[model samples]
Target: MPEHAEAGPSRTRPRAPRRKVYPTETFIDGRGDTLAIRTFAEEDTDLAGITRLCDEELSEPYNVYTFRYFLEDWPHLTFFVFPSADDPEPIATIICKLDMHRERTMRGYIGMLSVDKAWRRRSIARKLVELAMSRMELAGANEIVLETEFDNGPSLALYEAMGFVREKRVHRFYSNGKDAFRLIRPLAQHPLLSMAALRERQDAEQRSMAKEGGDNRSAVPPEIAVLLAGPLAPPTAAHADAMAELASLTIEPLPKPRPPPSYIM
Candidate 1:
């Protein structure tokens, strides 16, 4: 994890930095042939190259303008590229949006996940997703979700193998009237899931909070209970103080009624 900037003003605060867990390259063949998987950064002209590749290779029209859009709007979204290890240039790509709804929810919606036909069946898409999820989890997402064409057997199987279950099926969701299946995977659970260890980490957190007299009932209001329980971001001292003040106010009794409305005349 490369430290970029702290979440808070203090340098001592833990920063949610992005790290490339999987190397930018991986062996694709037993004979030492490899492929490079890289997260896209701003000012990368490779987006246009990969977009052109997808267009020419996959006949994908929807993504024709995606690369242009990505270059215009980077950072708000994440893009990953896969290049033949021998070439070390982008040949495939995937894009994901972080906090799409701004609900302070640790979730991401994957879009435009694709690999070139030349690289099909090479497990490059799967590797791209794995790499994306690692960055997403590290950035504080607890769940990652995506939608794919119902007829895309390979994509469906890949997602299922990665523990993504079909959450919904929408009819004619695509521009071409093809149905789409929405799949989701909780990053903090299930075996083989990269972030599964977070469950144990959360348990340890609960135990620590308990030791510090930080019961949920005392600290969180019913309205925001789910948010409080979520792993979005830890509260600041001011937030904690506000909650404590609210809790104290809620526990205080109403002031005694003023002498029954003064007397009637």
Candidate 2:
């Protein structure tokens, strides 16, 4: 009765849930305690804590390969925070990536961010995100994007407060079949300039082609003026006949090739 299912046989048992990462220290929000944020390093290849944190915080589980795909290429984008020098694991962690987008603009992506449950509401997550964003901005990212559960009010509010806008809704995005909302934060890109502002500028530049009433179609862009030239696209007589002949044809089966004689015999 499920709408969608995998092709292979279902497993008899569920996977062992990843280990939970607990904070070793409390992040003093406004108290200004000594914060211990550290970037990821090659020596810290054992990513058990980060994997566990993402599995629990997100709707999906990230295996070792998935973690490596991002971490290996952009280790600087991954960060952690410890409460004290003796803390073994991070109380907070954020992972991100940066690259050029198809639109020829630099883009940054926040893949995962996790903060220990005990350290919630203490500004730990905010600090981690800001740190990552700042680094990515400095690294030439023009915009950033991320996805979160649509119902996660705290996450939505937190990111929105940090200037991320809800861009679109993804239908059934998670493995557990939950919908997600994709958020985007433009670092220095002026979206208004591309949208309404661009439109206004273009409108202001619009000129009458017939102002002097002499062969005037040069006022608009070449493509627009071409479109205004009207619908005179017609096939030649021979081409039209060929097309009609092709359309009247029916599908025919091709003979299957015979196999060569067996060498084993």
Candidate 3:
């Protein structure tokens, strides 16, 4: 499913202000056209342009609510490319949001991306994505995720080139009954840190404790560890005998079957 939705109850604290001004960047494209990039501002009139770009290029039909969900909550996360410093109409735009996923980790979601056909092959999309990702990483996003049409080779290739991997395929995900591939890029987080050093330190501490006559029982029992290592193997002969003994002590054997009753004529 698309990441855009009603802000859930998991977000209880009030977020930062909605209309904070952000820095604007200017660059010259390959065609010698100067372009301006800036974060979406509440005062800007580029909403129509953004909607128009997506409506012109993408298949999904989005309403104003979808736009507001991403733009209003995370204005800084959305980037727009203008034709020049004075142009209010955006030629390209990318919308994104960051929120806690299942109350455990912060997840960043890219909801929409669109670029004008005239501006293709200029690497504008990549620049916008890189900007958004850097901001999200600074804001503590554990990972980023987005979905694109399964057959969109260009979209898939662009995302994969930026380190995203296909996580799964969702059937008939789009409004037009097109499949989508959910892609994910994991960022460096505490859970992914190497544990070898930690294990070695723990082993050394345990050895020191043993030398000092401290009781050092294994955290997990040997039998439980064996069971946890993998699927249980077939019961052994000794296990079968123990089970039989247990059954004999706890269960009563069935009585022999009695003959059927004769029916009276």
Highest lDDT: give the candidate number.
Answer: 3
Better of 1 and 2 by lDDT: 2
Full-model lDDT, candidate 2: 0.69
Off by over 4 Å in 2: 1-32, 43-46, 190-265
Clashing residue pairs, backbone N/CA/C < 3 A, model 3: none
lDDT of each: 0.60, 0.69, 0.74
Q: After superposition, how far is residue 148 of candidate 1 from its true place, in Å?
A: 0.5
TM-score of each: 0.57, 0.62, 0.64
Tens digit of lDDT per residue, candidate 1, span 143-191?
A: 8888888888988999999989999988877667788898988767322
> Ranking by lDDT, best first?
3, 2, 1
Instruction: Tell me each candidate's RMSD, in Å, in order.
Output: 20.6, 19.5, 21.3
lDDT tens per residue, model 3, 1-265? 3588766576568887664334578987767777899988773465787789889978898877677766666787988998876666788999888876655557788888898998888888888888888899888777888899999999999999999999999888887999899998888752233234444555676687788888774344343333333346665554555557647765332232222112100
The true-versus-predicted C-alpha distance at residue 50 of model 3, in Å, is: 1.6
Give candidate 1 regions above 4 Å deviation.
1-32, 41-44, 57-60, 63-65, 68-89, 100-104, 189-265
